[model samples]
Target: MTRKKGPKIVVIGGGTGLPVILKELHQRNAEITAIVTVADDGGSSGIIRDYVNVVPPGDIRNVMVALSDIAPEFKDIFQYRFRSQDKFLAGHAIGNLIIAALSEMRGGIDPAIRELSEMLQVEGHVYPASAQPLVLHAKFTDGTLLAGEAEITAAHKDIKEVWVGNNPWSENKKPHAVPEALQAIEEADEIILGPGSLFTSILPNLMIEDIGRAVLKAKAEIVYICNIMTQKGETINFTDAEHVRTLNRHLGQNFVDTVLVNTEIVPESYMDFNRYDEVSKQVVHDFKGLREQGARVISDNFLLLRDGGAFHDGQKVVDELMNVCSNPIKKRD
Candidate 1:
């Protein structure tokens, strides 16, 4: 007798939330493909990108560790951050440097990631959304514009729209997804977005011209795992429905077929502002608004607090995603 195959899941996003989802999905034996954002221009990733002229490796490193079935010591070495007094190596993760080196060795980010994935015993394919380094640009509701993912998030202004490009201030030379990234989406059984920053982590991938088009045209069910808490500069007062609306506004259509929302409440005093400064408050519920967006909302107690920070329970999210894959909603013509 032949064994049944697992669902093909393509997850799009970056930052901390993405790894959580990927690790859970890896354990479930799904055919996983992670399309990571290359628009990051801050922290260790930015430093490495500037020095080596490569895609930011911070998100990709985390995703690699998440899906890796390698030994614990090896994983630790990949994630190890240097604390040396030397300025060049200080504050950079070894894995970021390794990725930068490999990117140069292989002549491009896509090939570098492929080589790294094999060496790290990665359980799934990891593709950079674009081959080159990208910068994120945003137009605020007040008609103000900002460049760079870090700058845009730090502005604390209401964002009207966001896009990706080779240059920060100009939209010329629009970014395009690598062939592998596009093909993964086309072949996936389910595509999951978010559990990360709305404008920065998640939207940056979709902001790419051809990648956005591919997602809109893909036959699989596109599901969004809504953020558990409102982010300060990004989605300060955004309701659950507004989150979906923002995505649709960027993509030019209501393409998200399903949304997984956290129904559990966080006590007012439970939040530690100093520790979790980026988080604003618990996202308010608006089932009516979500339904208005034509999304089949699956609300549940998906919240998990660790060290006073709120996050999605990886298991719960994977369970919900599995259900969505098993009983997909009929596709729209």
Candidate 2:
């Protein structure tokens, strides 16, 4: 009998969710590739992108730390942020600054991430959705145009649609997924999206023309790990079906084959509103709606509560993903 190799998984998205899933997949010994969003324009990432003209490193740094097989202390040091009265560096994470510096030294973000990954002894590939920094542009149902991920989400208005492009202030330039990212998606055994901010974190990568096209064409079983809570500005009061609809709408087709939903309820009074203010309520369940969208639904008590917040159980998500890998879904012609 031959030993079967672990599955090749391509995880797309950014924000905190991607790292959580990546860490779990790494522990499962999956061949992982992370496609991080580059449309960030807030906090340490925003500042670094502004000054260095590189893709925001905050998301990439978090992903790197997650896949890194290095010492816990080293990961802490990489994630360290300054709290000095010095206005220049205050609130900037050490890893973000280092990544920015490396971007400059290496002449681009692609090379910089490669260098950092090796240094961190990363267990997988981390590719920015685009080589250059991107601006997220959203057209709200209110017919207002919002630029930048931070601004769009803050608008708190129902979004009609979104796209990735050159920074709004820069000369109009086309942005596409780097070849590595596209290749990863095309060759992947399973592609997972989300558990992250729908518009801001996950969609930015899919907004790239080639990346979206590749995903639609890929032979892999695409799985969307739906969020557990309704996001205030983005997906407020969004049902599980609405989540699938949003992704389908953005991709121009019903591409998702499976959706992993959390069936367990979050205690109404348990969440700390002050800490998780972005969460308005638990994501409403709509099994029939999800199935109607043509997704093979996998519902379970996949909830994990920590620090007064509800999150997907990483281990459970990976278990489902492994199942998807072994018993791949048939592609609709």
Candidate 3:
């Protein structure tokens, strides 16, 4: 008798939260593909993108590490960032530099990731949302427009919407998804989005035309791991339903099939503002609002608090995702 294979899952997002979920999914031996945002234009990724004119490597590198079978010590060394004293490589993670070099040597980010994924013993696929570096543009609710992910983030206003286009350094190249990403979405058993920054990390990937279109029409059950907290600059007062609504609004339809929401309350005085600076407060729940957007909510005590901050329990979230794959919710007609 042949052994059974696990479900095919395609996760779309960026930032620290994405890796946590990926790491847990890899442990379950799920067939995973991470479509990371390349609209980043800050930190080490920004410096490399500016100089090398390649897609930012930060998110992709993190995703690769999450899905890798490499030794623990090696993972640490890869994620280690230089101190300010190291003037030449200050604040840059070793993995970022390595990825940037590979991108140049391989002539494009997609090929570079493929080569690195093999070397790192990655158990899952990692693809940038766009083939080339994307310049993130936003239209604010105040009728203002800004370019660059960093600039848009720093604006700290209500973001009306966001879209991606060619990086200035790319001679006005257009943004398009790699073929692998499209294929992964087309064949996936389930699709997952976020536990990351609503505007910056998650939306940039979907704004790519081909990717967005594919997601809109995908046959798989799409689940969202909603953020535990509302972000200051992006989602200051956003509720769980609002988060899902915002996603639907951006996609021009209610594409999300299920949402994992945390019911565990963060203590009033327990929040350490110093550590989680950009966080405003816990994400308020509105099950009715979620239902209004055609999403079935799986509410649970899924919050994990540590180091004076709040986050989704990756184990719990992955458990829910696995359950969702096997027992998909019946969508209302």
TM agreement with the true structure for every prediction: 0.95, 0.96, 0.96
Predict model 3's lDDT versus the native: 0.89
C-alpha RMSD by candidate, in order: 2.7, 2.7, 2.5
Comparing 1 with 3 on lDDT, the higher-scoring candidate is: 1
lDDT, candidate 1, residue 173? 67
Cα lDDT over the full model 1: 0.90
lDDT of 1 at 273: 84
Give each model's clash number. Answer: 0, 0, 0
Candidate 2 lDDT at 84 equals 74
For model 2, the stretches where C-alpha displacement exceeds 4 angstroms are 1-5, 84-86, 168-172, 331-333
Candidate 3: RMSD over Cα atoms? 2.5
Error of 2 at 129 (Å): 0.3
Selected candidate, larger TM-score, 1 vs 2: 2
The stretch of ten residues in a row with the least summed lDDT in candidate 3 is 1-10
TM-score of structure candidate 2? 0.96
Which 10 residues in a row give candidate 1 its minimum summed lDDT? 167-176
Give one digit per residue, the lDDT tens place, for model 1 in 12-76: 99999999999999889588899999989999999888878888999999999999988999999
Off by over 4 Å in 1: 1-5, 84-86, 168-172
